[model samples]
Target: MPTNVSNLPPVRRWVPAPVTKEDIDWADLTFVDLAKAKTPEGRAEQVRLARDATHRQGFFYVINHGLDKAIVDRMIDIAALAFDDVSEEEKIRYRARIKETGEYLGYKLPQYWHIANGVKDRIEHYNFPRDVSRREHPNVLRPFLPEVQRIVEFTHRGVLNEVQKLLSLGLELPENTLPDLHPFDETNHSFWRFMLYNPRSQEEEDKTDNVWMKGHADHTSFTAIWSQPVTALQIKDWDGQWRYVRHVENALVVNCGDTTEYLSGGYYKSAVHRVIKPPSDQDGYRRLGLYYFHYMADDVRIAPLLDSPVVQREGVNKFIVGVPPVQETWRKNRASTYGVTQLERAEDGTEYEVVNGVRVTHYN
Candidate 1:
């Protein structure tokens, strides 16, 4: 941490630019109240709500998470400066080596990634791993690392831990061992992301039907996306229709990750979602996003807790034959993908691949 953080720029909270004026179709999502989740009686209420959320949509809104809005504002404020005030060359120095080493730490440049069918990908994001000291970041991020660390820890312990418990209780578990399975302070793939999606040209949009990202699922225990006012995010529903995920003020949109689906024995399969060009009304301005990508521990296996009554009730134990650690699975997928050499979908447009001896599926 910087000495006293005195040299850091004064906090100038970021004000949201005007939201889209377009009348867009939005999906109805269940909201899990964290304030209620903290209480004994309310915990059960949240468990049911969360179960309903994970079961169908694999997505939901998390509200009253007790993460002070001001702190969030500060984080975004600092992130804005980090992106806007620095040189691309300097930022690129810390870019993640996802292709080379299967690592997603530090900065990732816009348009650096390749997309299929001649579509140009546009994004610049920074990923700060759970262990902040694991890699160096841009100089501008140094002073705020302490507070950023606090925000990460708080989101894990205060916000995510509550939701994890709800999911755990929903499974009829005797104890909330989910915390032990996904510890906050451990060496995990969990990371905070500050991202920017720049506007695309009309010609580019025409080529891809305004699709900014292809269908994909995250390799995390759970993913927390700090809601931003841009109608670009959409999820593939059960009927295979694309539905927009609405933006809720002060709510973190949470989704079940692939790893969690494996752990739950398909009780809640990971949802597939993607980004598209901002609606015409919102396309004029760039979209800035804040997120906490929560991955399982390095050594957590991809298998259900058979002891759980729900898993047993689900059916005959037909999970991974020889389960592998999630870290290896994540590493294989990360290293293989990212425009180097397209790994043909295992079958019928799927991200099914055998990694670490487990059959993992994440559509891409």
Candidate 2:
């Protein structure tokens, strides 16, 4: 039977009091302005801030890490055009399919009562995989129009670069986890673009009793989100209080994923989050967002960070670095033993599937 939203955990009645510029945690979550990571001391401070925030709140707001604002605006504009101007027929063409080989692009809707029953998410999105060459999968390059195309490409590249920097700071490995190349290359990692539309009509808003995304953690190592100035985004704080993450101009919200949680051996947390249906007044405008899910190279093994005292306290031992050779063994054993999975869903609603025991998820 389909799950109804009403039966899910009661929408926490407590919404965070509005956040102002003054409330922003500059020391822990704001953007860094330097051309590169700071000196040893600065680097340590940044890492400490990120680690503490992840361990406690599982979410943080980022600024000044060097993403181009023009690019962000262009991407947001293109996303609006794709959803607003493109014909429904054209958008449907990019829908994902689930086959014996694996899941591919197509549109999916939530089944009634699905969330409460542990059914898959009921949302529609466009899936573009970064692992497959654009030539091999031309659909990956398809956008509703030419301008949209340019914006998507640029946004993909820009965000990937930022992701590399984040990974470098979080991981203490000598070699860089993100390879040098065009930001959105499919050869080295997986990248995807997801455009979401939540309902706005009065009928839809009233149906919130049976609708909205359920609580869940992302499966990738980390995710970068550019949310439209809408009201649906919410995060669970350390105190188990639900706080609304209102959209801030030119800011990207970063959160750890399940993979990061496992590799950090619980030193960092994969934040629990969900989407709620907006109130009637705000529903008319569709919610727009672009997410870049970052992954380690195909062979990266997720052992705890050795230098951190937290890992020692958690009993995580040092292990060889690089992707595990037996991907299936690693996935099953990791999830069962450590309680997390590597494969995850992008904002685009595309599932990153393992192929032939290889971790084929995007690393951007």
Strongest candidate by lDDT:
1
Query: Where is the poorest 10-residue window by lDDT in model 1?
Result: 1-10
Local distance difference test scores for all models = 0.75, 0.50
After the best TM-score superposition of candidate 1, give how far the Cα of residue 71 lies from its true spot, in angstroms.
1.8
What's the C-alpha lDDT at position 333 in model 2? 37
Q: Compute the lDDT of residue 271 as modeled in candidate 2.
A: 82
Residue lDDT tens for model 1, 252-329: 999888777877888876888888877767757778888887766777766777777887888534455664456656
Off by over 4 Å in 1: 1-9, 316-321, 326-332, 335-339, 345-354, 357-364
lDDT of 2 at 146: 45
